[model samples]
Target chain A: EADIYQTPRYLVIGTGKKITLECSQTMGHDKMYWYQQDPGMELHLIHYSYGVNSTEKGDLSSESTVSRIRTEHFPLTLESARPSHTSQYLCASSGTRSSNYGYTFGSGTRLTVV
Target chain B: AQTVTQSQPEMSVQEAETVTLSCTYDTSESDYYLFWYKQPPSRQMILVIRQEAYKQQNATENRFSVNFQKAAKSFSLKISDSQLGDAAMYFCALRQGAQKLVFGQGTRLTINP
Candidate 1:
């Protein structure tokens, strides 16, 4: 089945540790996005990519970085994790054709920095 | 930048009852798209329904329907015959052209037995 996937559904790491959250999609969509969400709060777009070798920062200021080397992969990395970095990270993708279908989101990764 | 607003932070409905979740948005563009997403405790975002800006008809999916007032920029979701499975966090989102989705603060819907 064609769908988006996110690895390490839950993570716990010490402060200052480097971590990466993996996200991949089989839908063959060109646009991918990463969002950070806190409990009972709205989602904040951290990063997005139009296609391979294309990436941009979203409205929210994020310390994390993302790369889109392949059409299917869009991974997010935190060079130095902190307690405040704990949050649920969601991955989503959409085609360029229409916004009517909306973005297909992955299950998401819940990271807790100790 | 387009912004989505969910005025109700939380709402509840008894089983088999109906409830409406309110949502409003701000945008300068005329053409766009609106969506309602459900996020359960499992934390997966699921698309409930969508409406096109140019369409006069409101969007509906089974027991789920939307009341869209384009002129007022208000989009509300109504759930009829609410079930326990309907308990989840609902988010209103907006998208214009090829831009990324802007999500609302979300309304936590609780289905009381």
Candidate 2:
């Protein structure tokens, strides 16, 4: 089973409120990623990190920011939530070895900005 | 940059039967990787199978197998003995080396019992 975890399985917050989505892994993966998806829609990459202190923006432009201070934790923060930001956020992690290249994804957080 | 495409928006098959889901990708890099992931109603991305670009042998995982045509740039998933548990949104993903994964729109698979 995948060891990655994401907190706040579901969230509902008011507009303009700041929110943070937490993601962690116990498998000691060096690469982590965040993807946003509408219900039953395509998943768009938002943010990714190579390792601690390394972060990069993905194909999709996201207002949220992510930090990887530790190898296990990669948290995404939204400065001001909006109704448009309401979507499911998925976190995934992969190891450095070729044998472990496939991603192990988290259950994902469903956010609703009202 | 690489792009993954799933032409079928949705597909269905009867239980105990077989079905195929089409996936095609475009990439300039010679060395890359292709993957198929299944997302159930719970919305967790599950890696079903993976195929390396350099490998000529198709990757297979029990009931799940892939038809990888490198020259055609097509990677299709074939599920033998379709099960209800297989009903989900299937995504085709591409990754080159250590870069981030790129996913296709996804195909929703349904199993009729």
Candidate 3:
């Protein structure tokens, strides 16, 4: 298994609450990604980081923001949680530079806002 | 943007039989990468196989192999002697260089007893 780890495997929070999804990797990979996937569906790239202090939004329009402070950790935060934010968040890391360098994905955090 | 298409929404095969999942991608770039990922009920995305566009020879790993046709823009996976463990949702994805991946909606594979 990849050394990538994501905290809060599942989250259920009230609307208007602030939330942070934590992702970490011990492999010292230069690339990190966050994907949002609904139940049994395609994975949508929400955010990605090339390295520390560099983050970019993916093709999908996402309200969440991400920061890459340290090489090992990339955390995503939401200002205010909403029902539209409810979905499975997957954190992944790639060790190599190949376009298809097979991302090592976490078990994922299934979030439900009510 | 590169786009991947998996025409089959669902597929099934008897245990010990062979099954194939189809995938096609659209890309103007000559160099790129292709991948097939297996997501079980656990929801962890596991890479089943990959093929580089530069390579003409197909890539194979154990019972899993990819039929990559760069000219035709097709990449498919064939599973031989399918097992119960092979049941999962399969995603076909495309990537340009070392960038983000574009994935298909996925195909659910069932291994019938």
Candidate 4:
């Protein structure tokens, strides 16, 4: 079955630790996105990509950065994690946001910085 | 930029009953799309249904349906014959033409015994 995957369902780390959140999809979608959400809040888009090697910052400015070296993979990284960076990171891909189908999301990575 | 709003912080429905969760949005563009996504306790965001701006008829999936009042900028979800599995957080999302989606604060649905 085609699906999106994220690694380390939950993570807890100390401040200043380098962390990477992995995201991959079996579907050959060209558009991929990264979103951050606090508990019970609206998800905020932090980064997005149109295709391989193409990435753009999203509506919400984020300290983390993302890279799209392959169509199926988009990874987000924090050079130095902080308590303020603790949140749920969600990965999604879509054919087109304008299309009726909308986006397919992963289970997400819940990070806690202590 | 588009914005979505889900006024109800939470809602409850008895098994086999029906419940509706309200959603509203603000957008300058005339053409857009609306979606209802379900996030279960497992934390997977699943698409429940979608509606196109050009379509006058509302969208439905099994026990799930939408009441889309485009002129009023309101899109609400109606779940019929609610089951325990229907208990989840539902998010209302809006997309303008071909951009990233704007999501509302979710509405947590609790199915009571």
Better of 1 and 2 by lDDT: 1
lDDT of 4 at B52: 88
- Across B1-113, the per-residue lDDT of candidate 4 in tens digits comes to 58899999999999999999999999988898999999988679999999988899999899999999989999999999999999999999998766778899999999999
Measured against the true chain A, the candidates' chain A TM-scores are 0.96, 0.94, 0.93, 0.95
Error of 1 at A35 (Å): 0.4
lDDT tens digits, residue span A1-114, model 4: 999999989999999999999999998888999999888656888999999999999988999999999999999999999999989999999864324588999999999999
> Candidate 3 at residue B76, lDDT?
92
Deviating ranges (above 4 Å) for candidate 2:
A98-100
In the order shown, the candidates' DockQ scores are 0.80, 0.67, 0.70, 0.75
For model 1 the local lDDT of residue B89 reads 95
lDDT of 4 at B1: 56
When 1 and 3 are scored with lDDT, the better candidate is 1
Q: Lowest-scoring 10 consecutive residues by lDDT in candidate 4 chain A? A: A94-103
Q: Pick the candidate with the highest TM-score.
A: 1
In candidate 3 chain A, where is summed lDDT lowest over 10 consecutive residues?
Answer: A95-104
Residue A112 deviation, candidate 1, in Å? Answer: 0.6
What does candidate 3's lDDT look like per residue over A39-67, in tens digits? 66778889999898999998789999999
| Top candidate (lDDT) | 1
RMSD of 2: 1.4
Rank by DockQ (best first): 1, 4, 3, 2
User: Candidate 4: RMSD over Cα atoms?
Assistant: 1.6
TM-score-sorted candidate list, best first: 1, 2, 4, 3
Question: CAPRI band of model 2?
Answer: medium
